[model samples]
Target: MKTDTIKRVLGYTAPYRLNLIAGFVCALLYVLFTLLGPVLIGRAIDQVFGPGNVNYQGVVFYLALLAVTVLLAAAFQWVLNVCTRNVSAWAANDLRRDAFAVLNRVPLKYIDGHSHGDIISRMVNDAELVAEGLLQGLTQLLPGVATILGTLCVMAVLNPFIALVVVLVTPVSIWFAGFVARRTDGFFRAQSAAQGKLSGYINEMVAGQSIVRSFGYEQRCFEEFDKISDELYETGLKSVFYSSITNPGTRFVNAIVYAAVAVFGALSAISGSISVGQLSCFLTYANQYTKPFNEVTGVLTQMQTALASAERLFAVLDAEPETPDAPDALEPKKCEGAVRVENVAFSYTPKVPLIENFHLDVKPGQRIAIVGPTGCGKTTLINLLMRFYDVREGAIYVDGNEIRTLKRNALRGMYGMVLQETWLKNATVRENIAYGKPDATLEEITAAAKAAYAHGFIKRLPQGYDTMIEPGGGNLSAGQKQLLCIARIMLCQPEMLILDEATSSIDTRTEMLIQQAFEKLIQGRTSFVVAHRLSTIQSADVILVMNAGRIVEQGTHASLLEKGGFYANLYNSQFAVE
Candidate 1:
């Protein structure tokens, strides 16, 4: 693991440090009591035939001591498990929460640039991996270390020659495990990344399954999925194979340490320097000393996986958040809705300029209709006005004050937007309608829904306004969803309105009704209407025709037609086709 990643992963445990400390203490006591079992058994062995007689009482007493040690060890081990489990669960929970918060705080550009599924994988799958790994580390590692150290102390005091032999052979186990760990580390990282990509691809396919079947893309989609799945398989197999070797490799080394102790210990016993029971204790101690190495190496795979996942999680946590509001930002209670765009320039990418030298001036309460072919900066202008993307040059002003100086939330609160893409939460029809004003009463919600001509359909549902809606309004028709969105904006009654192809999904008859509803909704409010059907906006007080990121013409419907300029050509072409 990288040093930085290790520090960061450990940081999550800092908040639960007390639990970790308690776990460590329990592990220490557990190991101490466990080591006592061997010593007491050795004593009992000596007592069985003490002084050429069967010392039954002495053996029974030591056996009782052995039982006590076993019970104590198990008790401490239980406490240790509880502490470690709590620490792991809490740490993982905090890590996941922080990852989610980062997603919300990051800029929309970041969201657009990354895969949504990949982000979700980092938050869910990767976090669980870290928790599992942490749990294994705590459960095995702390006790394993304590057992190894405690065994060494007992072994050295009982017989230093055998202890020397055990110590000399221990390094071989450590070195072997370390070598295998280094080799498997890269494969583990690759495996984690491949898993994320596979998850992303699966999410995209499942969410858009309808489009896939409609276009007969199942075969191609499966091929793509197979490719990603195969990559994950290859990396996973290699990492597991390499890490799997560490356990057996250390076990082989441990067997050597045990054999050497047996050989040397028996010689001392025969030489009358040590009792048979002492020799038996030395053999057990040698095995105990090497057990930790075997157990630690056994869990190496999980630890490597955890480290890989931690790196992925940290990548998201380290992402830069959206730009902060200006220190002296204004929070206007009400905006007059007068907007001006002065010599603005912007592009999603540095190399491709999408909007350049754009200028517009609109007085408060004027209904400005924007019309252009697709990709002519109509939506881009709206995005700029909402500060979704700030201008690269010049400035935008609302009510004669530069918008950059305004708080983002306050500025956005002043405008009611209804995009062509309708989004609804998993909530009741009433709750969805009152989304803009959460505290709205039923009467107010009904009034807004009635204005959008949605009240009739809503009343026809099984539960009327209380009917539950599925996510993305999947249970509702496209037009029904759009109507709910219009009702949402109507409830807000913002100072300004932005309707971007808002009624595109409705039928002609419903569109006429909505247009009438919008006439009342937009009255006395500064509304910017982006319409492709030119007839709907003929009554607009002013029409701004855009082309290639610039306003090519602007005038009233009659005056623009008389000019026979770009606006006239566009209006004539659209109507002629209709």
Candidate 2:
């Protein structure tokens, strides 16, 4: 709705100016030849009613010209469509590429807070709307404007009085279009929002169908879905109703304008101010002049909806991305993995801080185990260490260099991480293991898998290590997936490692193998292991016990057990459950 949004949409056509100009020129020439038809026909009419004998030869000559004009105009109209399509294709491609790239650059918080399905809808659905609108827009706008201007010029030249009547009547149709737009903008916007919500709900239902079935909540899920669907139906009705009325409304106004033009021109002819031939020409031009207004109005009606879609895409394109590194940002060739968190404070939202004045001093090559209850800021701490969110009150330093002053890639590249929720692309087992080190050889991949005790099960499969991983790793056992993740970190050989609830899903037998693999991988590398299972971290060089975003206790596992503090109570409780 903003002038700036319209300006930005039009600016996309600037790069294709030559194509647009050529299309406009073709459209103009087509309209010009179209206008010539009326002139030639008027001449033929005059030839039939002349003072002397009828001029059959002149009429044939004029008819031949008219036929040629029609054919030539058809060729240029084809050219116009081709040129406009080319312009629109390129602009759409540019928009899609930029819109997709914005996702990569935006802050993680944005992605976390918004629904993934709604984001996809904007990128795919709304963006497609904008593209289709651009195509329709260029086709209608350029030719429509040219035809209107050209027809008005011819009409004004032929009969100024009738042209005055047409120019005056034009505002009636314009006013109708304006009224439609005012009534339609809010509906289209609401319609788009409801559609996005429906898509998001559907996506959520599909992904969580297993939970629904397990909990006997099929009816409940359907009821929830129906609520969103009903909202979409209502909004869709309003949008369609308003948009559909535009064409008919403009057509009605156009009919009135044409009737006015005929009546006034008839009076002018009776008064002898305009000749009969000229009057015929004026009548023809009157229709020609107003038809473009009608087409333009229809296009505007369609654009009101498309502009809603464009606004969503533009919002994403304009969102604030991750914070940039300083002017003198560092990109170290290697890191020693000594991380220091100095007075860090952060929160996912305002007025509800999660971590405040948190500090840590980690020595290089030390294995630090983090143990805490759920929602006690354990994962949030790891997020901060990874620089997924910048600290508001303090700085995190890696290898004695401030992380904020280092390029994000350089800072994150030092550590290879595996979270509780494993991620495996739908690729071969070999490709999955070699994700971080893509160029690794088959022997190297096999060796890494062997270290994680995954090479045995992998080789027994139908395709051996070449077996394709299904989406969500649904084809593999949870343990097999965990081992593959471990193998990836082994191949990458990062200076630091983060294992968050890494062995939670593995069976006891596989957990032992995985822990052995972790011991080998953790050797001589600074590692942060977050776990609820106390037995897994008894051998950790240092144990950090956190609660409510601060470390309540910090020491070796044996030393903490001896002190019998909060960590002692947590350790005893877990063992009692076992």
Per-residue lDDT of candidate 1, residues 1-578 (tens digit): 46788788879999998999999999999999988888888888887665678778988999999899999999999999999989988998999999999888887788889888898899999999999998988899889999988998888888888888888988999999989998899999999999999989998998788899999999999999999999999999999998999999999999999999999999999998888888888888888888888877888899899999999999999899878898999999878989999999999999998889988999999999999899999998999999887889999999988988999999899999999989999999999999989999999999999999999999999899999998768789999999999999988899999999999999899899999999998889899999999999999988999998988899899999999999888878876853
Q: List TM-scores for all candidates, in order.
A: 0.95, 0.93
Question: Which of the numbered candidates is closest to the native, going by highest lDDT?
Answer: 1
Clashes of 2: 0
In candidate 2, what are the lDDT values of residues 11-117, reduced to their tens digit? 88799999988999998898889889889888887788656778999989999999999999999989999998888778877877888898999889989988888
As a TM-score, model 2 comes out at: 0.93
Candidate 1 Cα lDDT to native? 0.91
The best candidate by TM-score is 1
The per-prediction CA RMSD against the true structure, in angstroms, equals 2.1, 2.5
Error of 1 at 235 (Å): 1.5
| Angstrom error at residue 160, model 2 | 1.1
